[model samples]
Target chain A: MRSEEYLQKYHGVTKFLRILAQISFWLVVVLGAASLALGVATLFMSSDSFTFNFLDNIRLSMDGVLQFDLSLANITATTKKEIITTILFALSSFAIIYGLIISQLTSFLKTVENGMPFASANVKRLNMIGILFIVGSFIINTVYGLVANKIIHALGISTLSVNLQSDANMLFMGIIIIILAGIFRYGSYLQDEYDATI
Target chain B: MAIILRLDRMLADRKMQQNDLAEKVGISVVNLSNIKTGKVKAIRFSTLDAICRELKCQPGDILEYQAE
Candidate 1:
């Protein structure tokens, strides 16, 4: 296919990804709120009733008092901590995945902006998507961090004590990718405009 | 960054209006305007070939590249 047609096809796919990213973003927000609520409720619940487990690292051991045909409430404090860590890790993982997706989208937007020649409407919308990804991703990630901190504080835990074990390098890479995408998008727009006059 | 489109210059030099060229080439004036203004990011090889034949000019007469 010709370059223009190929770009048009690419735009279609990117638009789909944009929609998916938006859905995932909202999901993260909702999940973050739910997790915070749980953390707050956990603070009010009695320690004896507390139960949690992590994957393969710790075993669930309940208080040996209530032993009337019980098979569920068998988790220890260590297990609970591990479980919380796991949940935090999952949230961070989702954030990372979404970040990478937005990074790639921004890159593609830049490529389109670079004088590949598209409908003005298409070009405008693509730029808008790029802006949305950059701004929305940052907002969502920031909110996630803040909410996690709030939950930790509400549970009488030091927020800084809990660290999600995502690679900092990867996060940095995602940010860089996004920044480059924005730059490219802007450059492409200017080029497209100048080319018009030529 | 310095890619140059000379299609407009060529058309001007030939004293040919874009509409006339579009008519001669059997294409819409909108498409021809896209080429001249570089609004269209790309032109199909067939379209380029037609434009060249109609204008009696080479692709080089229409496009030039300069470094950013």
Candidate 2:
């Protein structure tokens, strides 16, 4: 199909994606706020044995490094507090990064909806998201792993062998996005050429 | 770019304004201005043909090359 036809066909798709991104952005905001409230609430509660069921569901166990004893009955207050702190850290970071990602996606889709998909704005947004993925993935996982190890030591589980692996999927996805941004940059260059040409 | 546009000189030689050339060549004055100022990365063959026809000049008259 011709360029105009292709754009016409996908214009609806971009619009739909923009709407989805907007919804996801707000959801992230609301959920992130709730998590912050919950974390703060737990801090004031004067009990270590008192573990939230939802917190229990969000497991951050590494392979043989740190294992969460899901049986909240057996967990010490210090261990529980440490785990909660770690989870809050991870989740807050995720919400922030994810919020940024969704916002960038919304902006990109808006550009596409306006028939400027190859504009430099979209390229920059993609690059920003790509960098966020790469850096955030490494920092969050490594920090979580380290904090978990500290918890293991605190609990004196010296017998459990520690093995922490970086999230390969997110790293790969970040690399792919950066590559795509490069391609979009080239497309933007061509667009400039086309537009400037008489 | 190595390929330089001499459209400004050609327009001068023809004593023609950008508006006249753009109207005659069926292109916007902005595009003709870009060509005259060497702001465009390339000229499409159809546009080159149109410009040439309107200017009554050869493509070589509007285009030149110089090593940087």
Candidate 3:
């Protein structure tokens, strides 16, 4: 059948989900950049010199060499912990909000797959919600950075050495976030194409 | 939510069997039954056009709006 033959309205929820998905995509972009910058900066020094930069600065207490004779192994252990924590923080926040949006989107998509036409406004609303999430993530990152700096000064670690181990981990996470965001955005585009074909 | 499909009405007025209508429209008997019973969540334009053309009726004739 010709695509133009279908004249039903777009579902409200489906549109909202698309927009939300796109917004998260952008959030990943901004967060990725900030994470990379901070991570790279920290790699130049030890936790003592790193000072508080965010909630992560609290981890400075873990500084100091391990008993392991292999220097590489010791450093690897510490770095692994920091990387895991950073990724967990990012993934958890996104998961919570995205989960809600995804549920709604899935419901809407099912209806659409059945050949129902939804209202145009509903699609626009979904788009707006996604954008809001993207903006919210950026704001959160900024707040985290500000708080981290204040805490570092309060702890008198401002003049200390940079935490090379933690910084390396952060840098890796930043790169990952950016890449994930791109992949997600691409997914959305594919969804649109799929819908159109249908 | 209270909109009623007048498919049965059309079928009766045209004195056509459900099976014959389904075959003529190139749709399955199950789907035709769903439409007749208002169990369908949606109707594609192509499907609507096919039914209308076959039955010699308009969409308005088969769709009725009723307040909930």
How many steric overlaps are in each model, in order? 3, 0, 21
| lDDT by residue (tens digit), candidate 1, B1-68 | 36577878888878889888888877788878877766676666777777788778998888898888
Q: What is the TM-score of chain A alone in each candidate?
A: 0.44, 0.79, 0.31
Off by over 4 Å in 2: A48-86, A139-163, B1-17, B64-68
> Candidate 3: how large is its RMSD?
13.9
TM-score ranking, high to low: 2, 1, 3
Off by over 4 Å in 1: A1-3, A51-168, A175-179, A182-186, A195-198, B1-68
Model 3 Cα lDDT, one tens digit per residue, A23-109:
665666456556555555545545555233343322332224322121122233345335434544544454544455554455445
Q: Provide per-model DockQ scores.
A: 0.09, 0.61, 0.05
Q: Write the residue-wise lDDT of candidate 2 on A43-161 in tens digits.
A: 77776456555444344465447556534435566667766666666566678878888999899899888888899887899999899888877876776677667666655677754
How does chain A of candidate 3 score by TM-score against the true chain A?
A: 0.31
As for candidate 2, its clashing pairs are none
Candidate 2 per-residue C-alpha lDDT over B1-68 given as tens digits, one digit per residue, 9 for 90 to 100? 89999998988999999899899888888878888888877789999998888889999998998999
User: Local distance difference test, per candidate?
Assistant: 0.57, 0.80, 0.56
Candidate 3 regions with alpha-carbon error over 4 angstroms: A1-139, A150-198, B1-6, B13-15, B28-68
Local lDDT at B60 for model 1: 84
| Candidate 1 CAPRI-style tier | incorrect
Candidate that would win on lDDT: 2
